[model samples]
Target: MNFETPSVSLNTSPENESHDEQFVNNDTLEFKYKVLSYYNEGKSINQCAKYFNIDRRIISRWKKVESQIFQTKIKRKRCAVKSIIDRSHFPILETQLYSWINEKRHQGICLSIILIKLQAINMFNTIYKNTPESSLEFKASNGWFGNFCYRKNLVLRRITTSGRDLPKNSVEIIKQFFSENCQYTKHEFFKDWQHG
Candidate 1:
């Protein structure tokens, strides 16, 4: 009985040849599996190059690093994505801000984007009170706010407005109640006031 080894073809088009070649080169795991498969089947290095459309030098390098790759499970060093605010830049301020947000959340308060931006500005001001002229200014721009929210996995939801019209004198009644209540000082009453 006679047996013949099966032939493998990359079947790449001229348009996609470079793209496919780059993918195979970048994908270490797939390349390793292919190399091992061809080697096990008694295929030559030149044969692998012709079938896989990869360089012979790359195949030699892969062979040299095969043991290390298998040992490390093909782990690759990845560069971490940078954030808008670095903790190293303003460590204390960031820590305080994080704590304040957690405290507010624990109190069951819903935060809006505007509210967060305002609070961030306040915190930045308070932390840098002595260094007013410092170059490290925190404008708390919309882009920075957005990135902060993303980094913290916090979602800012808008308050739903009621469409119904209020009765005439509702504002007067509210003002009267606030004035009569000893718990609300005149300053606090006006500060928390919202007119519809």
Candidate 2:
């Protein structure tokens, strides 16, 4: 209650803000949780707002749904908005993207959020390339990404290695490398091995 709103917050939370004008609450989900924790620690909403460089009104809104915010952070790493988004926005584009994701997942390739969003924008451009409206663009905002995950039943999890063991075909790969690259007599190790 003792906090006053500044004219404009020029600097936001470092390393967590995206200067996206449309989706202003571009702070990471973890950051949001931290802000709420700060507020819950007997700090005023206005104080948390000023300290975090976010709007006081936004801080208040987050306070109302503090529990949900924490749950969201647990479920995922980032969230653009806490409210529900459009159920179905881009049908064809989403269908293609979902399929692309499944295809890559099957290939044992884990795609990051940035990579997925970038691919989404690329797909959007390609899908709507012939559209008459030049304003049809997709920035692949985090909100959209969240909703996309929800609709597609995709879960984002931290990348962890299954084990530290090398591949079972390691010996074959090494033999292939030596056979393909260095058949010449210029290398001492190769000369010794050949003689041996």
Candidate 3:
């Protein structure tokens, strides 16, 4: 089968530039198919690499893992990378944590980072209750908590403190103040106001 590689553009702008920019080859799958076809047709690895504009080592490696890469029942959707949370191990943890967070938030309780981390540890321990202590994998460390927060879009905000004790009428008082002083300049108000 003939394979056509997609055209790649090097379009970039100063504003869009990033320090951690990655070079993404969009035609990786096409390249793999082309390499496999060429190799099977008795073409030399060097010839295939030169024709495809791919590295010789990459072509050779692809050839070595040809069966595993091409003949697998389940095709890989993403590049192989380590995830912060092993979803396979803790399948229900995300759903459980999401519900727990929602319940706590609905009850008007703000969760601190420490409290969230503690809760995660508790949840992990509960899930692995039957497993031996030595075999327990989840530690619910600070790093893990950070990843969890990022994944769940849970932001931890600092609780603001005020000096004066605010009454229930504070919102009404604020609205009244704004309504009364809406048109007056600060200088005009201070100059015209009588001393108490």
Which model is ahead, 1 or 2, in terms of lDDT? 2
Instruction: State the weakest 10-residue window (summed lDDT) of model 2.
Output: 14-23
User: TM-score of each candidate?
Assistant: 0.39, 0.39, 0.40
Write the residue-wise lDDT of candidate 3 on 1-196 in tens digits: 8586546435644533441132235245554665788888988988776555567887777777786557544455334323344553455665688789889999999888778777877887786687655376776777777776767777878788847789989999999987998798877777767553
Tell me, what's the RMSD of every candidate?
A: 15.4, 15.7, 16.7
Clashing pairs in 3: none
Ranking by TM-score, best first?
A: 3, 1, 2
Residue 5 alpha-carbon offset, candidate 1, angstroms: 47
All candidates in order of lDDT, best leading: 2, 1, 3
Query: How would you encode candidate 2's per-residue C-alpha lDDT over 64-143 as one tens digit per residue?
Result: 77777766635666676645444667878899999999999899998999999999998888888887533766788999
User: Which candidate ranks first by TM-score, i.e. highest?
Assistant: 3
**Model 2 residue 33 lDDT?**
75
Query: Candidate 1 — what's its lDDT?
Result: 0.68
Candidate 1 differs from the real structure by a C-alpha RMSD in angstroms, to one decimal, of 15.4
lDDT of 3: 0.68
Q: Cα lDDT of model 2 overall?
A: 0.78
